[model samples]
Target: MPKNGAPTRTRILDAAEALVIDHGYAATSVDDVIAASASSKGAFFHHFASKQALADALVERYVAADLEMLDSGLAAARAAGPDPAVRAVAFLDHFVGLADGLMGEQSGCLYAAVLTERQLLTSQTSAPIATAIRAWRDGFAALLREALPAGSPIDVDDLADHVFVTFEGAFLLARSTEDPSHLRRQLGVLRALVETALAAGPQEERR
Candidate 1:
């Protein structure tokens, strides 16, 4: 737990997360974090044994926060209706709404940024990163399993993976093109695909 209104450690991690997103993990040095966080070198080391340790903590914290946000969205979706398909679509729409709000700031995902620089990450740091990705995929899969009609032709696991991949790709494209609509458009397509699949029922071809 963080001490006081904001602990020194939390401040350090926050600074590191923002810097890493802006300037790749490899480029963000301890000194940079210390300066941004307004903490002494000793204070930084007291919280983290090494830079790798700090990186690990950052990923852990980030992933946990993200999951919490997703869970809240899921809860809201469930509360929105009794129909599983409608709830699922509502969840996806919630995600789209969140992504749309991020557009004006152009703030890319921290996880995506770190994964892109995976080569620079140590084994310790990489573990949590992989866990985070899997957690997201699994979470989506569970939702699809509950939402899709029984005996539907769609592969829940595969579609879940596809959604995660598409999200990452959309972020990359949006960042590269300097256009936030790229992500919004991609999400719109995903929502449409889900609606189409639900509409088709169990008789649709497996392909």
Candidate 2:
């Protein structure tokens, strides 16, 4: 819409993301993205080498966007000196809001769809997904670790991993059921878990 090549590239990725969410990786072809994006084949190839490369680029773009959103709200909450529980709630609020919009779409998570046919993605493509997942987990772990009292023995990394998987699973269920309530219910459970984990850490810890 910008009437420029950069916008064209973005359009290509946006179209590819939707198509991948709708049709999936193997089912989607380069021609599909070009057509959906209203861009030329040359333009598509100029941006990516192959369909695999395009998928990788899409994943990278998607993850970067998500991380940016998480950082923006979490950083604000940290600076405001909110207690760990409040900060945790703020984090989930931001995260759930993002996922809610994505789930509200007819097409669900682009990566989750591609994950069904993950074999199609080479290691190069998978690496970004793995990295994004790890970074998200680490971010949560850091928050939880800070929330805990001094010398608490809880394993924040493991807890964050569990929470991440729970969140992803809930999103999958919500998408499959076309029920946003599934995600909301799961977030409630997670919020309780975060509070319990923090409370169980140390008695001296306070807001």
Candidate 3:
């Protein structure tokens, strides 16, 4: 629906995404996005049918970028070694480093910010957000499964969910407390949990 050039659209999205991260979705208006983008009202409406349409586009763009980053980290970790357990530890190390770097720069996760406003969003606007979250969880679960020895006592799927939860919590805590070390400590706990599980070896089923 955007009548303007791709550059114009990107500009609008870029401006809008930054505002949403700093100001939450409910507080960000179309006019605000237009003003930030330095585009005319017509240009804004042309690219997006409505404010919700803009929201959907932003979520899609952010989610895609997030997945790409995660995939890159995973690939790097996998390349570090052939053993699943080793790769698993490498993945956590890579992820922790990524988190530390982002926190160091004080960059908040867009998906986490938007999720807090989900009640204000329509299904059309929220579906992509949910899908992105699921993809993240599934990706981590796959890595955990690969890393754990067969019959390991720890539940790979559950641990993956915990990883997601812990990261989100860490972000909230770090932002609220103005301390990136909160996230670092949480990642430490995550590494410890993974290491403990790996050391436990496979478990036998009880009769």
Q: Model 2: clashing residue pairs?
A: none
lDDT of 1: 0.79
* Poorest lDDT segment (10 consecutive residues) of candidate 1: 118-127
Model 1: per-residue lDDT, tens digit, 82-162?
887888788778877877776665457777767767664546666666776677678777778888777787888788776
Candidate 3, 1-207: lDDT as tens digits: 345455889999988988987889889999999998889899999999988888889888987887787787679767988887787778778877777787875456677767778654545666776776687678778878887777887777788777667777898888788888777789888988888887786777679
Question: What is the lDDT of every predicted structure here?
Answer: 0.79, 0.74, 0.79
Question: How many clashes in candidate 3?
Answer: 1
Could you list the CA RMSD of all candidates, in the order they appear?
A: 3.5, 4.4, 3.8
Where does candidate 1 stray beyond 4 Å?
1-5, 103-106, 118-122, 203-207
Q: Is candidate 1 or candidate 2 better by lDDT?
A: 1
Clashing pairs in 1: none
What lDDT, from 0 to 1, does candidate 3 have? 0.79
